[model samples]
Target chain A: MSLSESTSRRRKKRANGVEFTAKEFKRQWILIAIAAVYVIYGIIFYYLPLAGWIMAFQNYKYKTGITGSKFVGLAKFQFLFSDAKFLQVIRNTFCMGALNLIFSTVMAIVFAILLNEIKNIWGKKIVQTISYLPHFLSWIVVCGLVHDALSSTGIINELLVKFGIIDSPFQFFASKPWFWPLVVLTNLWKETGWNAIIYLAAITSIDPALYESASIDGAGRFQKMWYVTLPSIRPTIMILLLMNIGNVLNAGFELQYILGNGVIQSVSRTIDIYVLDWAINGRNMDFSLGTAAGIFKTLVALILIVAGNTIAKKTGDERLF
Target chain B: MSINTMKPKKKKMATEDLIFTIFNTTIMVLFTIVTLYPILNTLAISFNEGSDAVRGGIHLLPRVFSLKSYKTVIKTEGIITGAKITVLRTVIGTLSSLIANALLSFILSRKRFLFKSGLSLFWIITMYANGGLIPTMVLFRSLNLIGTFWVYVIPGMVSAFNVMVMRTYMAGIPDSLEESAQLEGAGYMTVFLKIISPLCKPVYATIALFVAVYHWNSWFDAMLYNRTNTKYTTLQYELQKLLASVTAQGQGGGGGAASQTDATVATVIPITIRSAATILTMAPIIALYPFLQRYFVTGLTIGGVKE
Candidate 1:
């Protein structure tokens, strides 16, 4: 059946340009028809809501709706900047984000390098599989484990007290100082193995010949790793770092939300939580304020990504965009 | 002295290599232990007597084994309902999203498709920018998706990230196969269903695992869009509530003070119940983890790295 149709198509192609164009148009239109479903879905779900950004500039009330709400240019943004709570939230977000980014990157790189040094294939595979298990777990589950480990009666406190490091179990979660480190440590524990896979792949893809030459030059294992392995994967490292820099604002919502209590809320709240508090929380529902904060986050994220890509392009040819 | 045949130098290096190997192996063992300890500890605690577990000596094994926590968790009305909803969402959400994304990606991957770049650009922008929380909620409300089951499956059906991943994978398939199928008079849908999809199994497994795991693990949506709707609550959300209440109790009683009395703790869902529920929630992902590990690395590298 297809052979006959193809033959007819060929004959038509030879017979007239107009007919061929018309048939071709029909073929392409089917593709367009399929594309239309998602495109329309995208407009409704993704793009159409962008119209709600207008709420940011208005004293948006549920009764008045977006159109009828009184327009108050720059007021919401000004309030957000002036509010000490918002400023603290911003600081918390940046600190936690930077901490996670720095430690996770460094730890993953180090882990990957050390993992590559393992000569036993089965051992390497087993360790890697175990390491990635946490990444697949939900933040709630992870936090459950963390809380179990850090609870006054939990293992960490037990060990600490047992070893005479402390006379009593320490409150790891209750204190203000431990929050940032805890966030960073949790992120590292969850992400290091998963993130290391990319670096490991880069290491595997590095020309074995480079290592051979380095060995010939009397470079020891550490020396070869330093000179050959690190340099070879520099591009991968830079690309990942740039991508992460773009996502810095994400400094994690689920982890914080799951683990945070009233005591730790000051340290744990991120911009996302700020948005949720104002927009969704019943008592604090300020649509305009939430929209303004959300808009600020979105703008900063876009700027960071674009800037990171531009920097990547300038430093090397590894631009994400 | 060309070192390829230098016995003395090789012997000297062998000692250093052995030391390095031992060191590396030790670190890996420690890392593995650190990673696995908490999970195993949780399992142990879950199985141990709920009252005894609060005393906190359980490590790798249960000192006093009991199925009481699991029995309690299984008996909970919310958890059972949440499990049903979770399973339904995972099955339906994964299938629908996979089909929708695969179709859209197939169109985008075609070389001669007229809207390829335009549609590609449209989807890509959605990846970078979104209308934030309030607006998205407002949109969903206006569309009457709020408090509906469809909110879980529909809003996420056509994610740009998934589309991009699938598109990149499809674009790499040799065009000759698709062209031959076309010459056989296979329509676009037929070509996608028969030719492209069968060949795209690895990517499909990768994506299926991705989407399925996401649906299973997602609770925020349940909390956000369906907060008031008890009918659509998910397992994770229920677990979240349990966790919150447990933590609150822990804080209020100053961590184990309440657990000092078995009678007082029996009324509240203790840590053991939380652990049992957690294990139940994560059991499916753990069961399918081997499949995930097998496909994700290759799949992610293909879809993510090249771009």
Candidate 2:
């Protein structure tokens, strides 16, 4: 149905209700109409821009809109595959995603495990506060902070110099070898605390009696922790891991966008950044290529989510569904 | 205030607990240091004299600290206008969002509500599906909302996640409260407004903060459609321009347009100026975080567990 027809139907629905009058429908509809507006907004803004997807099918012209543009059809897609940068971005997205997932989960689990071992309430709370703080920082801020620290004359280089680790300051940002690792490590540092929170909550929920029973059986501290705490939070870990698998394509847009200067340009350009640069950043909006990129992202995200959900269903665990 | 101090008698600590305490203290201190470093560095750079920051002189602390960057920011044209616009958007956006979320969530929370499953599934589908940006832009243009204030506020006024959270919280509320209110001949609106909304103070506050923060932090809508429309640019978007454009200018790609636009002396405090803008943008959000952190662990923890 068109937007107006839907509004009329909404008016009908309002009229039939007990307290609803035709006038209240306008007010309630103005309020309840937000849903319709949301749907309409999604249709108008999100979906309709997709019609420009044809730009991918054509040698798009800025003077003429998508309709007036020449029809090329699958040529852009073919050109994309032929482009060597496509392979690098795909590889970069996956490799970075994998590292981020592995590092974040492992660090979170470790932090949660160690936190569980802590008896001092105030101390544990402090750790929680401090660790979670980075999660709140915008990538803009985080990148600025990183620039300050990792620049040649920054604290890290100074410390390295004072300790005589290097003859001269090195440009870490320029080093290809350090690019991916730095991205992963900084991500781990920012996310581990926030990510660990869910696990910590899960860890706390695990029955204490299990640990007490293990202790009664003469289980040592290590043995009890291994046999109890780790096992208890396993399901939570799996769920998050599975969820991460679905989000593997989202190797972060902001961080890559900011940190990716000309030095690490080849390795750092993920799919999202590619879309922003080619589609949004440049002089002419390449709606077709941009839509194609968005479609690829959407399709990959959908497939991964369904695949993960299916796996989750088979395992008989909690799923986003 | 001293009531607990004088009455406390069991001050003894367990031996195992003592070791654990030390271990935990060390962990907390280490993590705290990690968390504080970046923020402290940013703040320090923001406060540092412009030239010192450009030369990479500041570290964990400022060197010959100065308020020049902030002075430039405050004196810049349209800053108060930007701040006023941001504050207004946050308030109106939160109000409309809260209303829509509360109404929808309340309806969906009831099993007896008409078309509950279907309507909810519609929202759930929205999480996964989109028609792309071109169509959306066309639709908004057709609707005449492109250059209007409604463009920002209407499109994103309600979030599915907030709706789900509020619904979960509403489900937890006893039906007896509503039943008794109905017995007093109150309508659904009255019952909801009088009883449920008040009872949901914590949840409301949490969601309000979430929506408010989202509005305050968002520069995307403005970036997408507001570049030419000087009146519609939010504070975050304007600050983003101040931050990003300066860098673009310094790279000689844009010829120092941004720093020159400020009408202040073109000082070479590039990093310091960027840091200053960052701090100003994040200040209110960071301040609000600690206050509402209780909700993250308490009321909002409902859907986190599977079983």
Candidate 3:
């Protein structure tokens, strides 16, 4: 059939309630072709890795590869659990991640609220702009700046010594106890402003009439902020909080890897660094063990996400999925 | 007496509001200073005489003004090569990913596309679950992409998040426009290239900036897959190595026989060079940020609201 005739026939078929027709197929052929390319790309880069997860169950050797490796039945996972260093790494990850989450979230919200209260448009714009500047910087650059500012001879230590906060300049990087807080601070410095942007948007969407009503009810500035603004953006806050919960284990590796030294390694090592230390850099590279640790991390993240979503659903709030 | 008291109370409330505004503005100004001081300090250190920078009190301005560090950094072979590679990858990576993602989004946004749900589901599943780092590394190695430049470009050619954002943007473009073009016998490619591409400029710019910045900042992948190859090192990775070397030298001064020499060397020039390298690394992004900031904000709002 000619194209036009077939299309007309398809229209007749549609009138008879046929959902799809050959004419529609022909028309969508180009789109289908384009989508196929994405499907192939997705399969290779994404789905292929999922299939590669099977290596976690095997004694994965480089020479033998995943397909040729022997099925080990969770021996690698057992090894990860038995390792004391790994446990320490997990503890460090949780501590750093939790601190980061709490600090960044609270700071972002507070910053957003404070920013929204600014009556001067120029001041608000300038502050918001400057705040997000750090977010654009690479962690490599941020860590370099951090090291410069916190080094023994750096301004921060110099100021502390001059102010008599300390008798002498201290090596911030060398102190194990300072690692978690430093990580949190660095994360806050880089991310708080960027994160605040979302909250700021959320605040903007709030009804002006609500604020007007609050004012008519004789609410003060603080009272309106507390009762009207906060409650209005609460759903946004809850959704973001739930999403962050799912990332509790992803403390990240770059900052710790860059800033960590021999003296502070105990506090600085995260799950990612631990895996890299064993799987890629150790005396005997254990691929299966590393894969198993990764698998464990992914499973925990999945559980956290599902649990978070469940909680959000139960609370009648926004759910990520 | 009650009416007179109400007037005073209203005046008091106005003063209270004024105080709050002033208080809020002060905090913001302080916050801005805190955010800006570090960058300015880094810049100052970079411009300071190498020897003078080590004395360590250069707060807001260069103490002994000199361009020695910048000259040295610019002349360094490692940094120049690393920068060239970084720029090359960022351009290629961003362009390829943007095109690929745009295509996927266009396909998915079409109401008549049969496999939209399945395609979206395939990408979404990957977002939440992954095979983890080791397997991905092994896969890359097996594919012989470890030392190749394609490793950077190919693996990130399509970001699901960008695809979704673009899809959302595309969905907003009136379907009647495309229908009219189709009625005139314009093919899908013509419709996309002529109609949709021009219309989706805002989202395109947003995604492009994001992909470009990501490529520019990425170091971990270069550190991992390109470990054996110095030629593949990016600017961030090179700077990381330079910083590590400086720290290593500083730490070694504590116990090594060459402690005195190392200390002198550290005090002489390493800090300034490190600062200069850092400033150089951040210069491009910081320069371009103001112009690109609005698009990012718009993108964020669109993505956040849709979700």
CAPRI level of candidate 2: incorrect
Candidate that would win on TM-score: 3
Model 3 C-alpha lDDT per residue in residues B1-307, reported as the tens digit of each score = 9899889889999999889888887888888887888899999999999877778889989989999999999998878988999999999999998999898889877777766556767776776787888889988987899998889899888877788789878978998999999999999999899999999999999999999999999988887888678788889987877787655555532422112111222333378898999999989999899889998888887753446
Q: What is the iRMSD of the candidate numbered 1?
A: 8.6
lDDT of 2 at B54: 69
**Cα lDDT computed for each candidate against the true fold:** 0.83, 0.69, 0.82
For candidate 3, the per-residue lDDT at B48 reads 91
All candidates: TM-score: 0.93, 0.83, 0.94
List candidate 3 stretches off by more than 4 Å. Answer: A1-18, B249-269
Kindly report the docking quality category of candidate 1: acceptable
Comparing 1 with 3 on TM-score, the higher-scoring candidate is: 3
Share of reference contacts kept by candidate 3 = 0.59
Residues B43-99, model 2: lDDT tens digits: 998898987676775667888779998988777665566777789898999999898
Model-by-model DockQ, in order? 0.41, 0.21, 0.46
| Clashing residue pair totals per candidate (backbone < 3 A) | 0, 15, 0
Off by over 4 Å in 1: A1-23, B1-11, B252-268
* CA lDDT, candidate 1, residue B282: 91
Q: Return the candidate ranking by lDDT, descending.
A: 1, 3, 2
